[model samples]
Target chain A: MRTHSAIAEPGAIRWTLTAFAVAFLALFVALPVASVFLQAFEHGPGAYLAALTDPEALSAIRLTLVAAALSVPLNTVFGVTAAWLIAKYDFAGRGVLLTLIDLPFAVSPVIAGLIFVLLFGAHGLLGPLLSRHEVRVIFAVPGIVLATTFVTFPFVVREVLPILESQGSDQEEAAVTLGASGLTVFFRVTLPRIKWGLLYGVILCNARAMGEFGAVSVVSGHIRGETNTMPLHVEILYNEYNFVGAFAVASLLALLALATLLAKRLLGDGSHGGQGQPGASQEAR
Target chain B: MSVTVRNLTKRFTASAGSPRAPAVADASFEAPDGAITTLLGPSGSGKTTVLRAIAGLEQPDSGTILLDGVDCTAIPARRRGVGFVFQGYALFAHMSVRDNIAFGLQVRKMPRKEIAERVDELLSLVQLEGLGARYPKQLSGGQQQRVAFARALATRPRVLLLDEPFGALDAQVRVELRSWLQRLHAQTHVTTLLVTHDQEEALELSQHVVLMRAGRIEQVGTPHDLYDHPSTPFVASFIGGATVLRGRVEGTRAAIGPLSVAAPDGALEGAGLQAFVRPHDVRIARATDQSAVSLGKIEKLVRVGGFVKVELRLPSGEAMTVQMAKTELDALGVAEGDRVLVDLLAAKVFVEDYSI
Candidate 1:
């Protein structure tokens, strides 16, 4: 008697699924990205470079970098502390704390900006005190940074928490048993273990902070030279019907996204020079 | 340094508000200075919890731990001067073996040259001399365990705690590492508290064995004392291959299903007792032998290494096992289905109420 092999499906069925996936990715992702580069260079390289060097475009790039620089580090610190607290110990209302950390992911970015605006906007909560102190938050760089920080808050924590939890308390206890203090253990043992995941989170956070549009739009007031980030600048130029200028500046944001992807591929996958486990690469994702 | 734990107790509560039983309940034991003491028990026996409490890893609900006659229960694990080798080894995967061993000395802020020298010395001590540059994931399980041992010993801790140090290795590696651990213990002579469920490992490595059962210590004595004079049935059944036979006490003798055996001292009259007899102590002879107490049919014969194990069923339908040398079995010339007389030699009788 003959026995049937496992997974003895027809070859046509498998190829059909593979073809469908390829076609879907081409239509949704690759086409739009290719179109952006194609349109940006339509006016020739001279015109594209000229558009990018324009004063407003340069200021937008500078502002985007500044906002990302401020927000990513602040969020990174918060992320490590939050992940450490949530992962390392059992406490009351831990579920609620986790939900709060995840709040930004579930909330709409526009709504996130609105919440900050309601707290620090003119005629909003804390507005009277802020005005008395002569501090400007709404329609300023601070408001842009605030909105970007809120949206990117969960990335690092989300990446690092599961890694910490799975690694467990054994190594930390061993460190303590070896006469290491709490700070030394964190730096020498815990930090080195979770560094790859932490880097992966920070890269993604930096990318999102630079490209944030909806939340920054709600708060930036669109003051072109002062408050416009790269994503907001692309919108401003496009609204003025400067198509070449818009897509050119937009390509810079695309380049930032590509760089983020490249860095993630190098560091996040543990395929580069590192001793991190292959299992950790998936957690980095 | 000697270590003593007095009445350590710990309980884990379920999230649903039900209070579970204590993991360790009033468990107490002592590890003498310059000796190895093993906490021996099956899983859920709270042996590990006791070891952790002694290591300052777990906070006892109520107990005092004394290290070298100093009450150190409130001290944190870092300052307790105890080294623990976890069951999984818990080697830092990112660090090379040298850096892993150097971690404790580095944390103490030792001079750079001294730290390197100490790490080199430890690398040689655990016999992983040339492998210091390799990461933990590159080594075998036994090598990883040796690195963990080296790292724990780097601080020159007053006491060493090992939780099933060889639990993850194969049988041959386990035996090899057990002897390696014995030699290491002799050289260091740090008061060591080891927790293991393997009976043979505990009997072989420990100068004193503390037998635990269900969150309580059942007995604590030297290895020979616990093996030869087990105070309770759990100790007897747990330590060696002992077949239990229920019998009723008749004055100083216990009658077990058509066979009468001499009872242990202090067995009360007309009381139910359990006769714990090792397979080797159950002797077999021909039916014509006058000293035989009962006739049994040989049911099975299994040759195990240098000995033969004989399974027999008595006339009352109770089964018993007898182990003898292969030469003795050849002389007896008994085949399956043949009737033979059985004699009980050196059986210990315990009151059935004490049986767990």
Candidate 2:
């Protein structure tokens, strides 16, 4: 049988486009990251350790980690619940809910942060009430966490919704008929099926939460010891003319982004995994 | 457990651009304990709908389903103690064979040890003991079907329902599984209702066959009764491909196309009526020079199995078929273009007005 091999289209345009794309990516993406790392190592290993242990940089790293940890689980739970409702049920106002969930993604992060400020700032709506209640939202840890969460919320839902849709409702119904209670069926059958997708969603959410800057900057107030995250610290150091410290913080965030890329590769994008007993290979594809 | 469905009526409202077709209407039958009752019909014949209604997967407009004399109409599918093997086998793809079978037990909050023991028992019972670690996707089509059966039975339901269980399998697998299913049913003695459009399967496996058509039960009886003594013209034609011949009646004797048949019961609604004849019961005779035996000409002869299906055109230009055995065919030496005669022997006749 003569098969139409895709390899047969080894045209000049294909090779040219492939070369052009590789060259373009290397020049635009790979070079800048390599320069950052190369500069980070310009100082001796002792200077690198001293810069890493800087009190201001340490606080920023701790704040970013705390915010990401808080936001990732919250986003995960919200994403799974929303995805389940949208994918599994037919109800009124469903399209509106989906639009609202995706609205954060479409809207500018700066605008989103400004909206939170307008609602929680001193002269804004609910501002006086919050002050009287001593409930601080802007210029606080909650503000930074909330901003990051809003920007990162859609990652999990977007990744899991289509997976839930294609997995179908038959197996779950079969479990129900087998005398399994609702919770048991979810843990035993439904979770195993959706776990890989859920993990992918979580990884994306974590990456977004860790890297979020525009929204957090608008609300975080950038207090040195209290609220400044790594992105805000990087900007502060750059404005203060400490190029090495600024690049160092940026390098750490870049590393987190790199980790996310590696995670995605290992998991095979949730769809490419040899359909295993769902959660058995959660570490990788 | 025996299941009795009475006065079941379900009317499906017309969905855009199509006529309002009732999936099930006024259907009723009893599947006794330890017996396989098959609801046999064509694709749109409401057999599966009736089965699902009994399994509580479908909520009928009005009906009462009784399991062992207890009315279970209001009960949900989970509480009804009914196991359903879906057509597609709907196994949990994530779970291994052992885990799939143990799911119901684990949900019931059984002890961990008990769950494992019962899972093992089910695995061996389904003849999948060695493949306990395999996922549903890893198994062959037949093995997956057996796992599905085991998963359904692990709940220890009172009655088991299978909806076209072997429809997804190949012909050889289907036949092999049909015998295995029959043996499994015998060993477990669980009253089962299997819905199938395959008449051969229904005839071979079921103790009681319920033939349905157009949202109504055509006839319900033993397989022998349905095959041999069909009550309606539809049943006669649908069950075994019995051809109908229009005839004129005069008392007990009826004049068919170039032939005459005498009704044993001498029942008649009108002078003109229809006669039913099984192809196997009809005989073909070659023309003899001395005296031609019921003159006819063979229009087409199709060899099937050990018999040849002969479509003969009578002197009156009407066609009738006869299933002649290989030995009889060899002796008669009938060919497609040969001129012959057809003899109708002991064929049941019904009134033409009640044809459908």
Pick by lDDT: which candidate is best? 1
Residue B310's lDDT in candidate 2? 86
TM-score for each prediction?
Answer: 0.94, 0.86
> Which digits, one per residue and each the tens of the lDDT, describe model 1 over residues A1-285?
556479765678889998999999999999999889988999899999999999999999999999999999999999999999999767788889899999999999999999989999988999999999999998998999999999999999998998999878898899989988989988988887788889989998999999898899999999978888989999989999998999999888999999999988877546344544532333444
Question: Quality of candidate 1's docking, in CAPRI categories?
Answer: medium
- Model 2, span A23-57: residue lDDT tens: 99999999999987776666756666667789989
Candidate 2 segments whose C-alpha is farther than 4 A from its true place? A1-7, A10-21, A42-52, A114-132, A221-226, A239-241, A269-285, B9-22, B111-117, B231-234, B244-256, B259-277, B289-297, B312-321, B346-356
Model 1, B1-356: lDDT tens digits are 88888998999777655789999999888889989999999999999988888888899999899999999999999999899999999887768888889988888899999999998898888999999888787799999999999999999999999999999999999999999999998888888989999989999998899999999999999999888899888999888878888889887789887777887678777789888889999888877764455889999999999899899988777788889999999998888888898888778788766434
DockQ of each: 0.58, 0.41
Report the alpha-carbon TM-score of model 1 versus the true structure. Answer: 0.94
Model 2 residue A117 distance off true place after TM-score fit, in angstroms: 4.2
lDDT score for residue A256 of model 2:
93
TM-score of chain A of 1: 0.92
Candidate whose DockQ is highest: 1
